[model samples]
Target: MPLWCHASPAAAGAAHSEPALPLAGGNARVSPEVSAEQDEEGEGDGRRWSSLVPELLADILRRVDADAEKWPKRRDVAVCACVCRRWREVTIALVRPPLHCGRVTLLSSLKQPGPRDAPLQCFIKRNKKKSTFHLYLSLTQALIDEGKFLLAAHRNKCGFHMEYIISIRGDLSHGSHVGKIKSNFTRTKFTICDLQPQYEGSKVPSSSCRPRLASKQIKPLASTGNVETGKVSYEYNLLKSRGPRRIRCSIRCPIEEDTEIDPRKAKKPSTPGSLVLYNKLPQWHEHLQCWCLNFHGRVMVASVKNFQLIAPAGAGGPWGIQDDDAVILQFGKIEDDVFTMDYRQPLSAFQAFAICLSSFGSKLVCE
Candidate 1:
């Protein structure tokens, strides 16, 4: 029997034993002693109220886990666990791999894969210019966080700050150099190049943004690059949107060296790698007055504050088709200004990060 259960019988006895003190009105009377015993029992009941059956509690926790996975950000689980001791124990037992098991504050916490089994946690702070962001990538789940100046970007002197140069570097002691990324902005397109070191010393022409071609001619665009290979690894292109605040994306490998020739064929032809496309553009919300990214055309949230990257359905075989729209990336807002990015395999930490960074700048120019 529970502690509250033992007190319940005593409370009933106390209520019966105490004599009623008659009042001046009629038959109504006050039983102070009985009331005191009942009050004590009520407090005990309050203490035991949360002692629900373990199986039922576990089921509730599973629902919470599912909801957390559905969220663009992973902090929902952390918030659920923080409710009370019972909830904390339940969540700790139910949450599985890839789910962060630490306390999250009102600061941006970027969770990516680390060298170790644990996921890397990165915090970001955008500079006042909206041109640069200070990043801190941690080795452990918590502790010893610092300012390493991981990345920065300078917007070209153009409307919308659409075109800019992004640089990713090592710490001050480690060389102070890594690579650069360039974004091409146009009337109907936006493109991000693979990171390359050669771009570090290249100067932007004073009239780079000036219109040089006739209205009907399309201008050629340069690709941005990274330092790891100094060559184009991947190219991400943003196509013209059909309507306001909407866009589509396509990603392809920079080099397509995979070629094969049959004995009867005259020459071997190279085929490009599979093309990855991002669509189902988010819509502008009338009530919120902001663009909302819809998950499965169901759950919707402000796009500027948070969004996700998911693989389109039907690519996988018949058995795997159900999970076609699975999430590949999750971005969420922690504070008013800070946000996080989490991505899965086939994408390097840098690559996943670059994709998220692409979402930061203005898109109205392309529309």
Candidate 2:
């Protein structure tokens, strides 16, 4: 029952790429119908669209949320949601503890633990840069819905605090692509890290080009960070591919620690770092999916989650991945039903990976 669910699923896909009202760096939510007329000299439509602040503001929030994983410069989605009165009311309410009945979005049947029954907040969305922690909603929660309609609360703890990046490479190095990730990621450690390049048009070398199905499904990993984050981590590298290449690095990390790729030090749009690792992990030819490992070096992602990785065509770059061959996670049983919680494995599932780039993870990089 989407705005146009009757239409083909492809139609929804079209909406995603439909020149979303041509918004720029700023989050300006102009109603689609009115946005086109914003530049016209005063008179009717221009003023009318300008007057419809609520509609425009909503659209702006929608767009900002869509790109939250990419151009991340803020903490609160409310920053985008509160551009207008209507959004402010909605966002503020969602953040309150013991969420009200109707403000939730994706939690269809999740049962929030009562203060007495609720588990102690084992996880917190502590935005290090923001100097705070958001223990309420999650990116998935926000993506599920922003409107205040459903009311049930679930017991979804904040998962890991990392993104699993799958990459493809074209640079013929001395070692083969298959290797242990421990040595590569001396400092950082996650389920999957950028190890190669992605393709744009064609698959690279032996790799295929298959964009991941739902990169957004990647869960966050839990973290009790150690003492090694201060080391000099090498910057992500970008390379131009001779042919098409694809890479799918999907891992679960945490939302608490905002450790993503910075575009300022990145190479090209194609040379995206931690940012692109979001839903756009990558997909490729046919239906081949990449892989990851657990702490004990056992493959995971398949036994637990419902996600896979793919590579886009023409995805290659100059720099090598920081943790190309990192270990995949070993997630225990997580009741799909958030209402009923379990505690077999890591309480909070955060995605991580080991790359050959720099020293990450702890505060004082011993290496």
TM-score of each: 0.39, 0.19
Query: Candidate 1 versus the native: TM-score?
Result: 0.39
* Model 1 misplaced stretches (Cα beyond 4 Å): 1-123, 138-154, 158-164, 170-179, 196-245, 253-274, 279-305, 314-322, 365-367
299-334 per-residue lDDT for model 1 (tens digits): 222444355554456542321224555554555555
Q: Judging by lDDT against the true structure, name the best candidate.
A: 1
RMSD per prediction, one decimal? 22.4, 21.0
- What is the Å distance of residue 212 in model 2 from its true position? 21
Model 1, 262: alpha-carbon shift in Å?
33
On residues 1-367, what C-alpha lDDT tens digit does candidate 2 reach at each position? Answer: 0010112344333333343333435654444344445435433332432344655555555554444331122233424232334443433333322222211222211122112121211112222342221112222222221222111111111243322121111121222121112223322333332222233443333213332334432112211112121111222323422112122343222112111122222244332222122111223335445332222221112322222121223221111213322112111212221111111110111122122111122322221
C-alpha-based local distance difference test score of model 2? 0.25
Consecutive 10-residue window with the lowest summed lDDT within model 2: 338-347
